[model samples]
Target: MSQTLDMFATDDYPALTAGVDEVGRGPLCGDVVAAAVILDPNRPIMGLNDSKKLTEKRRERLFDEIQQNALAFCIARASVAEIDELNILHASMLAMSRAVDGLQRAGESVKPEFVLVDGNRLPKWHYPSEAVVKGDSKVPAIAAASILAKVCRDREMCELDKKYPGYGLAGHKGYPTKVHLEALKTLGVTDIHRRSYGPVKALL
Candidate 1:
């Protein structure tokens, strides 16, 4: 674990620092989900990596392990309406902030002193934070956050598929795929869709 971490560890984030990341940003439907995680150095989980790079089985296994082992974790989301109103970028930031703020309420710890977020932009908040380009692969906490958010969002997408049915939300995960585009034209757009998105907007 030490050997692998050496290749991807953050500069010098103190313990109890929260790592933040979001998922479902590129999906044409559903809320953008985010998660914040503060790992317990004493109870480390293995095989942490970018959620996109991990198999569903591994992510599912780690998902439970992280919740069981982390000092704190919180998952949050920005709704489709918020996406339409704020734009995806700001909405994603809002969700990320909500996640970190949630940790204060949800975690055993009072608060995280520092935050490391995946990607290049940090949410507008009071916390001391840095946005790492690929922090999901670089930081263990971020990787844990990545898994939580992805699994949570993907599960929601599956449930949403049941509700919305014909859009094939389960298979495409709400991405603007060829099948999704075809469904949009044939069956029409649902309220779950981000009306601000190009394909969705055209239909509206």
Candidate 2:
């Protein structure tokens, strides 16, 4: 008989819980960023919500607060090359895994007794974790992870916009928006683009 894997084996909240989330999966460019946050129950930061639902000002504020208050937090990413080579979904998993691993090595690392990952898929890892639908909004730690990953990715895209101005990366953050597509058509694909993506591959 084959063994069964129970994703919710660790559903009960533990004293040390790490929430994992990824950002940039929908973008045609930029690395997929992931964050693992082990929030300190005693240092809770209110107003936690899915990063998308939060205003820019609120996200920025929470970003700092999460870093300051989390028992351990790590932001990790799979680069454009990794995304192109492994494909976005696998790359996202890799980034998520890396984030959790980083937390184990964090300056104040607290090995999580359980993990809650945002979205419907959980990365294959040794840690006991569950995949939660819309967990970013439902779980405080996941919300904090989303905020950190989003803010970090947004800032990186803004910096890249300075290097490659025509894509409006700062505004669209590398998503395949009309402006970004138009810019890609006129400017041609840059090195930062994921060559494996259909839109980018067509251009090449």
Full-model lDDT for every candidate? 0.90, 0.88
Distance from true location, Cα of 24 in model 2, Å:
0.3
Top-TM-score candidate index: 1
lDDT by residue for model 2 (7-67), tens? 2333468878898999998899989999999888678688888899889999999999999
TM-score of each: 0.95, 0.92
Give stretches of model 1 more than 4 Å off: 2-5, 104-109
lDDT by residue for model 1 (1-204), tens: 424444765557777799999998899999999999998888988899889989999999999999998888899999999999999999999999999988843535458889999999888899999898888887888999999999999999999999998899999999999999999999998999999999999998
Task: List RMSD in Å for every model shown.
Answer: 1.7, 6.1
